[model samples]
Target: MMAMTQLQSGDRAKIVDLSRVSELVRRRLLDMGVTEGVEVCLKCTMPLGGPFMIESCGQCLGIRRSEAMRIQVERV
Candidate 1:
């Protein structure tokens, strides 16, 4: 298992667990369709450490570092 934020571009992973920080943060990610057992791909990262793009469920989503840190994934 690895942190989603640590994945390199083009790598694929499956969401396994979420950080035990707060329900609000966890719910926010779930609302965006980032749930456990879902497959996600690291597409690209914006220059200058901005939000990174991930592909999942036929949609591409941009997530910031703070948000990404709350998600844990396993390489696939």
Candidate 2:
């Protein structure tokens, strides 16, 4: 397993788990399609520390670094 930040842009991976920091945050991610076993692709990371986007289930969603660190993934 690898942290989401370690993946390069365009890399595809399966979500493993979300950190236990916040239940609401985790639930929100799940609601937005970042569930365990779901495949997702890193789209792009903004320069200057902005949010990054991930493509999953035919949808692209942007998430901040703080939120992303909670996610663990494995290459697909």
Candidate 3:
């Protein structure tokens, strides 16, 4: 498993786990449909290694590199 942030643009992955981010952050992410076993696609990344855009559950989400690093996923 690797961080979702490590995935290349257009890569698809299945979320397996999430690191110990803050409880509120975790809840927020989960509320946005980023739970385990869900599949996500890396739609885009900022030019300077900033936030990443991911598609999941028919929704697009923007997350920071630090946040993405807590989301563990396996390539699909």
Model 2, poorest ten-residue lDDT window? 18-27
Candidate 2 Cα errors over 4 Å, as ranges? none
Candidate 3 on 1-76: residue-level lDDT in tens?
A: 9888789999999999876556777788789978889999999998786899999988998878888888889999
Which model scores highest in TM-score? 3
Tens-digit lDDT string for candidate 2 (1-76): 9888899999999999876437887777788977889999999999887888999999998888777777899998
Task: Residues 1-76, candidate 1: write the lDDT tens digits.
Answer: 8788899999999999875536876776688887899999999988887887999988888878767776889999
The residue pairs found clashing in candidate 3 are none
Ranking by TM-score: 3, 2, 1
Per-residue lDDT value at 17 in model 3: 86
**What local distance difference test score does each model get?**
0.84, 0.85, 0.87
Q: Is candidate 1 or candidate 3 better by lDDT?
A: 3
Q: Give each model a TM-score.
A: 0.82, 0.88, 0.88
Which prediction has more favorable TM-score, 1 or 2?
2
**Candidate 1 regions with alpha-carbon error over 4 angstroms:** 21-25
Q: What is the lDDT of residue 29 in candidate 3?
A: 79
